[model samples]
Target: MEKRYVLEWLDRAINEFNPTQTQSANFEDHRFKSFLKEVMDETARQIAYLKKLAFQYPKKRKFQEVLDLYFSALNNLIDNARLNLKLIASESVISKKALELVLASLADIHTFLLNRYTVSINPDEPLRKYNLAVPVIDFAQPTDNILLSNHPALASLIEDEFDAVFSTGNLANITPRQAKHWKDLNDQICTPEQQNPGDEYFCSLELLLIERNFNSTKFVKYLTNRFTSHMEEYASGNSIEKLAYIQKLFNQIPVIKGLAYDLQHDDLSLTINNWFICEIEFRSRSNTGKGREAPSTATKSNGCIKKTADKVLCKLTVDQLALFFKAADQSKIIAAKSLSAIFQAVAPYLSTPYKEDISHGSLRSKSYSVEGRDEEQLLSFLTKLTRQIEEL
Candidate 1:
C-alpha cells in the first residue's frame, strides 16, 4: 500500500470504531468485545503497512505525516481502552489480545528517529511484556510519576519522539553567515533597555532556537502547560526568586528535564540560562507575567547600583567573588537577607573611613569603585571570614 492510502485507512479505522455502539452499557457484550478485537487487529495490520510506507518515504515532511497518524492511532486506541477500564479489566482475554495488537504497533518506530543505529529501547524487556492494564490507566494521568513508574511504554514513545524531532543525524555545522545570524538573533531578543542580551536573555534565545530549529510547537505547548501548572502551585516571589522557582520546576519535571538531557547528549551547550528562558517564555505567554511581583523602586535602584558596582568589582575576578560568597555562606560568617546585607556586615571592618557613606544601593550594585587599599580590605575581609568559617 502507498503512504496516502495507509494514512486514510488508519484514520478511518480509528475514527470508525465506536465503543459506544454496543448493546450493553459497559462494553461487556461478547459481540462488542469481539468487534473491538477485530477492529484492533485490522488497525494493527494497517499500521504495519503505514510503517512500511513511512520507512520508504524519503522526505521528512511526508515521513512525519505518516508518523503523526501512526502515533495518533496508538494514542486513540489507548484512550479508548482507558475510557472503559472497568469493562477491559473484566474481559481479560479480549482486552489482553486486543491491547497486544496496539502495544506491538507502539514498539520502536525507528524510522521516526535521527539515529536509527542508536537503540534506546531494551530488547530484553519489550513493550508487550508489561501489564498493559496498569499502563493504559497510568498513561491517562498527567503526572510525571506515572510516566517514570508504571508507564514505560508511554515514556518510551515520548522519549523516542523527542529524540527523533531534536536529533541531528550528523554533526550540526554552522557557516560563518549562520554564526552571524545567531549573533543578530542574540541582539534582536534583547530588551529595549539593554542593547545587548545578557546571559539570561542569551539562554532564553537558545531555548527558543531549539524550538525553532525543530519546528515543533507540541513540545513547547506541553512545556508551557506543565510549567504554568507547576508555577501556579509555587509561592509568589520576586523576579529572581521566581526565576529560581522555574529552574527548580524545569529540573523536577520529567519531560522538560528529559529534553535537557537529550540536548546534552546531542552535544548542545547546556547553560544556567537554559532554565531562565522558561521564565521569559512563561511571562510572554501569560501576558502579565503573573506570579512574580514587580520589583519596588528601591530594588530597581539597587540593580542600577549593582551594574555600576560591577565595573570595579570586575577587578576581582568572578571566580574570586564566587569562592568568597560560597565560603562565607557555607561558614555562616554572615547571616543576611541579601548580598547587600553581607556587604554591610563586612563594610565596617574595611579600612576606608568613607565606608559609612557607601549607599546600600552601591553595595547592592556589583559594580563598585574600589582603590588598591580598598581592594586589599575586601580581600582581607574574605580571608577573615574564611578563617572564621574554618574554625567553625
Candidate 2:
C-alpha cells in the first residue's frame, strides 16, 4: 500500500477518536492493542461493504475498476494496521519500543502532516471521488494520559527527538559565513517585532541553541550565516508572510516554552529607533514572570536612569525592565476600578508601556499591562496600586 492511504486512515482515526481526560483514565497496554485491532476490523468491514456494493452494480462499466482500486487501498490499510497490531501484540507488556511504535504511528497519521508527505490516492477522476471508507461511528483513539503518561517517560521521548541543542533531524544543515549573518538572525528573532512562522522557527532554534549554551557553536555559526542571507533576500517582499509562518512553525514544533529571557541584555542603544520592538520584548518577558521574582526594585531601577541629551531612558537590560513591571503589576488587594485608574496614571516612559491586551490568540484573560516606561513610572504605578488597595 502507498503511504498515503495508511496516513489517511490514521489521520481519520486521530480526528475521530478524541479520548477525553476522563475516558483516558482506564487506558492500559491491553486497551492500546484493542484500539489497533478495532481499526483493522472496521477497515475490513468497509472493504467488504464496498465489495458487496460493487458486485450489485456489475452492469456499471467502471464498477469493477472502482472496486479493484478501493479494495486494494482499503485492504492495504488493513494489512498495515495488522502489522502495527502484530508489533503491539508481540510484546506481552507495553515496552518502550512498543510505546515508541505507537507514538510514531500517531505522528505519522496526524492530518496536517499528511499533506506534506507523498500522497498516492487514485488520482483518476472517477476513483478520486469514490472514497472506500465506511462511517467510523465507534472507534477508540488513545490519548496522552493513556500511553507514555508519566512526565519522565515523555521527557525521554522528547530527548530522543533532539540530537543536540540546535541539531534536530527536522532541519537541514548550513555552512557558516560571517558575523553579520549571525547578528541579523539574532536580531530578527531576539528583537520585539511580530515574528512570522519562519522567524518563530528561527527563534525556537535560537532558544535551543541558548539552552545548551551553544555547545555546537561551529554548526550553529554555519546555519546562522546561511539563514542571515535568506532573511536579507526575503525580508522585503515577504514581510506579511512572516506572520503566517509563526502559526505554521508553532504547529510544526509545538514544544516551545518559557521565552522568559530573550531580552534583559546590553544589546540595546543600536536599535533605539525601533524601541517598540523593545516594548514588545519587555511585555512578553513580564507576562512569563521572568523578571517578577528578581532581586530588582522599581526605586533601584529608576536610579539606573541616565540623563540623556533628549530622551529620559533607564540604563537597564530588557530583562530588568520586565522584572520591575512584573513586580509592580502584582497587587492582589486592589479593586478593578482603582487598578485601572492607577494604570492610566503611569502609562508613559515604559518601552512597551501599553497594558497587557485583555486577550490572547484564541483565549481570553482578565489581565492587562500596567507597566511604566522606566523605573519612575513603574514605581509610581506600584505606589498608586498599593495605596488604592490599602484604602479599599
Candidate 3:
C-alpha cells in the first residue's frame, strides 16, 4: 500500500476507536462499521497507485515538477474522502478529524519538502572612486546667474508657472506682475498687493524688493499671513494638534510677539510687527471724593522705527542678493546667515519706534513716547504707510 493510503486508513481507524463520542449511538451501528471498512480498502488502493507512479518517474522529469503533480493528485483525493466522511459522520467527529488532517499535512510538507530548490547568485560590481565635492560659493563673494538658476524654490516656481501657463493656453496673457507674484510667494515673501487688493504694480514691486534683499518689517507681517493661508490649504484632521505643538515652539521665540491662527486648516504664522508696532496703551485719571482733590496726570508711549537706508543700500548688490536668495532657498543655515548679515548691516539706520506704550521686558524705559495728539498723528502715518506698501 502507498504511504498516503496507509495514513488515510490509520486516520479513519483512530476516529472510530476514539471514546470521546459517548453521546452518539451511530458509532455502535453495523452499517457504520461496514462503511469504515470500505474507506480503509479504498485508501489502500490509492496508496498503491501513488507508489507505482513515483517509482516509474525516477529520472524522466524534474524532481520538483513531478513532486508537485503527485502532491496535487493526493490532495484532491484526500479532500474528496474528507468531504464524504463529513457527510456520513457526526458533526463533532468530522470537524475534529478535518482539523487534525490539515495540521498533519502541513507538518509533513514542511518537514519533507522545505527548501527543495537553490537560488542562483549574481556578483556585485566593485565600488568606483570619484570626487563628490560641490563647488563652494561664499555669500560674501559675487554669484553669477548660473548659481541663481540652481535655487530649488525659484527653479520650481519657474517650472510650475511655465507649465501652468502652457497647459492653460494662456502663455500670451502672462505678465511680469504674475511672474513677480509667483517669485515672491516661492520665497515666502509677501507683496503689498497680496495684503490688500491684487495689483500688477505692487506685485512687481514685491519682486523687486525680494531681488534687492530689502528688509521690510511691515512686509514680513503680510508675508506671515500669506504663509498661514498656504499652510491651511494642505492641513486636515490631526493638523490642529500639530499646529498646537508648533505654536508652543513659536511662542518661545522672543522676536515672535503674536500669532494669528487659521483653525479650519490649522495654519499658523508669526506676526512680529504686531507685537512691536501695533500695540496699544491706555491710561485714566480720576478724583476720589470732592474735598481737596489733587490734579492727576496720565501718559502714553509708543515703539520706535529707525531706517538706515544708505547703510543697507551700500552693502547690497545684485550678485549678493542673488546668492542670498539661492542660499536661502537651499538650506535654513544659509538663509539664516544671509538674513543676519543683511539685518546687521541695516540695523543702525532701520530702528523704528512704536507709537504706544509697548513693553519689551524693560521697566521705565520708552522707545517712542507719544501724547494724545501725537498718538493720532502717528496712527495716521502708520495707516498711510500700510496703504502705500499695499499699493506698491
Candidate 4:
C-alpha cells in the first residue's frame, strides 16, 4: 500500500468538509462541527461561483485579476492547513479542536478575499455598455488625396501637439536626462538620407494620437495586432501586471502607457524597443529638479508618475520575483543563507513603509492580487538584480 502524504489528508478534509451526522459526546463539539460545515459549504459556493464566471469569461482581463487574488488567498489558507495536518498527525494525543483550526482559518481569508473582489471588480453591465470598437487605418489606402499632399504640415501639427504634451508634464515623469537621451536617440533613428523611417513615423503617429487623448486609439495597437493574430508581439514577453499599468498610462497621455500598450499589443519597432530596454542606463547622477518649492512639489508629483511608469515597465511579477529569490537561495546567488535573509537583504529597496510588514505570504498573494506598491517594489528589486547579474 502506498503511504498517504499529509497534504493528501488535508486536501480530503477540505474537499469533503461535511461533518458526520452522528452526534458527538460533547454538545459544543457537535455545534462547532455543524457551524464549521456551514462555513465550508459557503466557501465552496463562492469558489464555485467564481470558477464558473472565470470559465465563462476566461479572456476577461479584469476578471482574471480577481481570480488570481482568490486563488492566492485560497492557496495561502490551504498551506496553513497542510502545516496543521502535519502537527495533528505527529501528536500522541490528537486534539480534535486543533483539527478545526484548519477549517477555521479559511473563514477569515475567504471573507477578506470576497470583500476585495467585490470592491475591485465592477459589474459586467457597465463594461458591456461601453463599446470600444477599433477603427480601420489602412496605410496603403488614402481616404483623401488633398490631405495626403499636405503630409509635411500634418507632421508638423503632430510634432507640435506632442511638444505640448511634453510641456504639460503629463507624460511619464521623465527627467531632463531621460528627455535628452530620447532626443539624442531620435537623431540616431533619423537616417543619413533623412527620409522618415517607417517605425519612426508609426511611433510618432502613436504619440500624436496619445497627445490627442482619444480612447479609441488608446488600445488601437493592441486591437489591431490581436485581430490580425500578429506574430510580432511583445506583451507576452513582459509582465502582464506591468503591461496593464502601461496600457493605463497610455490611456492618460502617458509615454509609459504608450510604451506599455505597444509592448503588449503590437510589435514595438527596433528603435523604440531598444529605447524602452535601455532607458534605465540613462539615469542622471544628481537630482536636476531640486531646490525651489514649486519644483519640489512638481518633483513629488512627477515622482509618483515615475513610480507608476517603473511598475508598468517592470518585466517581472511578484511571483516571478519569488521564483528568482528561490533560485538565488538554492544557488547561493547572494551570500545570504536563507530565503528570509535574502528578502531582508533586499527588503529596504522593495518593502513598503514598514519593512516588518513584508511577509512571504503577502508577497506571494500580491503576485496575483493587484497592488501598485508591490509591483513597483518588485520592479526595482528585479532591475537591481539584473544589473548585478550582468556584472557577474
Clash number for candidate 4: 1
Each model's lDDT: 0.39, 0.36, 0.35, 0.40
The residue pairs that clash in candidate 4, if any, are 250-257
lDDT sort, best first: 4, 1, 2, 3
Model 1 scores worst on lDDT over the 10 consecutive residues at 130-139
lDDT of 2: 0.36
Off by over 4 Å in 1: 1-19, 22-44, 85-392
Per-residue accuracy of model 2 over 88-161 as CA lDDT, tens digit each: 33333433333344344433333222242113232222221322221212211123222212233322433332
Which candidate comes out best when scored by TM-score? 1
Give the poorly placed runs of model 2, Cα more than 4 Å off: 1-215, 235-326, 331-339, 352-392
Model 2 TM: 0.21
Q: Report RMSD for candidate 2.
A: 22.3
Deviation (Å) of 224 in candidate 2: 3.7
Tens digits of lDDT, candidate 4, 38-100? 556655655556545555555778566545544554665565555544444333222345346
Model 4 regions lying over 4 Å from their true place:
1-140, 143-288, 291-323, 330-338, 349-392
Evaluated against the true structure, the overall lDDT of model 3 is: 0.35
Q: Can you give the lDDT of residue 163 in candidate 4?
A: 56
For residue 369, what is the lDDT in candidate 3? 31
